[model samples]
Target: MTKADVTGNNHTLEVRDTEQTMAQEKPTLTYFARRGLGEMPRLILVESGIEWTDNRVDTIDDLKASGKLPYGQVPLLEYPDGFSISQSGAIVRHIARQHGLYGKNDKEAAEADMVFDGANDLRLHSRATIGNDTLREKFISEVLPKWLGFFEAHLKKNGSSYFVGHDITFADIAVYNTFYNMQILIPAAKLEGFPLCQKHFESIASRPRIAEYLKSRPYTAT
Candidate 1:
């Protein structure tokens, strides 16, 4: 090759290498030592095949003092370029969008949001029952049936393995994580009646990267 052509090829290779390095830079997830809200983002990162740093904190005092938290909360996702966002739901959505796991198009994205919101509603309501006998019982007997039935019907209506479109999205991840958390809190609450929900949960869990994550992640009740 001519010298000029060799130089051009070298420049192209250099640019490609730099782009790869930037893509490989790991985004750091700042949260407590436990799973809590951090788990969803972690699952998404793993499933997306993105290597990330799980910066678990023992206490939020240091993080709060750092002034990085928008709402003084954990589950802050920070990229290598210093871009950061707080709020568990926002972080989850951001990662989903970044990785094209949000949905296929606007309509499917909205549907995905609907699924995630419904799953989140169940998560919020059920979390309130933590340590309360009557509330927990009511959640198991009443709330679970209501929400899980909705998910089952939605899944059947979609007529696919996913909650939104043909492919997996953050909506599926949200549902899987929600049920995983719920089951931890209420051990007796299994997906016995909800066949589709159970199948979806197992499907996501069995994904190679996600299954590896589930198997190796530190066990946490929350």
Candidate 2:
């Protein structure tokens, strides 16, 4: 079969029929050795059952030396045919769309985007307070509850365990990953006020593929 080429963000992608053959070489994902922004995309890839290479570089020096990255950023997803895509959220959306895990329709997709954006905002806010003990404490005591309460309300409105539609979506994965990182960063912080969100996290975590991947990797906040 002929291969099609698609480009994104100044990068080229060789689009071959995904059903070509199971023996076809898997794509490669390059990132720092830590979970950080790459974790959600990795989770999507793993849960989709797509075979991919996890290329972990330990240092920025090593990454620059490789000359394979487009933006010199970690979490770059590269195809076997030399095409690659950068940016964590984009990579996660690409994989989710490819695997039919993005959403069911336009409305669902929009809802998913809403949840993803909200989760990302929370993640950024939490990360900004990382090294400062006082800021982190204040964030946990005040800011965290507001965001968690918002998520809890959204989950209740959706009337399902997933953030969008009845099935798992990238939004659920995104929020879950953020929550997972928050727990890692602040072990004492509890989700008691957000029971629905807590259950939602557990639901995503218990997925067969996700559960296996979670067990295989070491605990990391980044």
Candidate 3:
């Protein structure tokens, strides 16, 4: 299906019953209304050209009350067969592998793993500081630089816009989402010296599918 067919302005999927379409069942991603950990996986799905469902929960209480989540957490991936997977990292990796975005070979996959883990580290730190203005400021001033600098160095070493080799991998998406969420949390935070990191984020965000998804989806701070 075309990007327009899968994700129109309303951000809703059109159900189809063709044999091929039915065989390739659309997965459903359950997450909070905010982007949070689910955004990257959503981006992966979009970039991979998969048409899926976005099941957003209005509140944590509502999610807990549902009692269908395997781990009582948002960002759960549920398949058509009623199987579900939890944890943001696992879900991202799963989708990446399914979509051939994990990496090209063993060496590239290892590099991708390193970059993805590093991005997750930064994400954890940023999430922990949310809602605390003082802590958030300190993170933006001190911690963010360390992580962003590491990413900048890696991007420079890679000698390309992507995090791993010539193509965009899960690591690239992870890093982009990390920076994207950081901007949401700390809008004033700037990539003063990290031109590569800035470019990396923009590159992923500007992908045709990713850009359309961003434009269609509602803004939600996490």
Candidate 4:
């Protein structure tokens, strides 16, 4: 096995000999070397414990030139059997469904979807504040609190470490990703007054596989 570091981004890719691992046929996720929309899917892949290729790239020219991207975008998930999908949300859900990280029943699945959407809403708002100090201040002071309050109440109602059912789901990882990105953007942001949210974040972070991925994942600003 060899790890290839992507140029300009310093992102690492875990490579294995094709002759040795061809039978397993590992999946590959192609995306820019950033923890933006790609992060949650990557997290789900790691948590699933399936050896996959983290195919990070500095540009999508090759992919676009190849016309393989359905929407001409990154974050494309491709299986060895020619099954491929685009869009981050769908990719995350598909992987979750395949690995039992999705909720068990239809109702539980709906609940998980709801939580995932809500977390995505927060993520979008937070992302908009990236370079604008005015928006950033407003987001930190007003927007974040509102979203955190919702998550706090949601977790309190669930009465468990997970967001949907008894076990961890994609929704739990989505929430964790949102909080993780927020902390990356604002180092001083705290979950004060939202104990459930705090505990939830810590709980997800401490999961065995997740902890390992967090420790070794390539550093990114967002």
Model 1 segments beyond 4 Å from truth?
1-20
The clash count for each model shown is: 0, 1, 0, 0
Model 1 lDDT per residue over 104-151, tens place: 899999999999999899999789898899999989899999998999
| Ranked by TM-score, top first | 1, 4, 2, 3
Where is model 4 more than 4 Å wrong at Cα?
1-25
Model 2 over residues 124-146: C-alpha lDDT tens digits?
87887878999788888888999
Give the alpha carbon lDDT tens digit for every residue of 69-173 in model 4: 999997999988888999999999999998999899999999999999999998888888878899888887998899999998888888878888699999999
lDDT tens digits by residue: candidate 3, 1-222? 674665563333434335456556788888888787788888888888887898887766765777766678878888888777888888888889888998899899999999999988998888888779888888978998988889889989889879899998989988888888878777877777899988888899899999999999988756
For candidate 1, the lDDT comes to 0.88
**Clashing residue pairs found in predicted model 1:** none
TM-score of 4: 0.87
Query: Which 10 consecutive residues of model 1 have the lowest summed lDDT?
Result: 1-10
lDDT of each: 0.88, 0.83, 0.84, 0.87
Clashing pairs for predicted structure model 3, backbone only: none
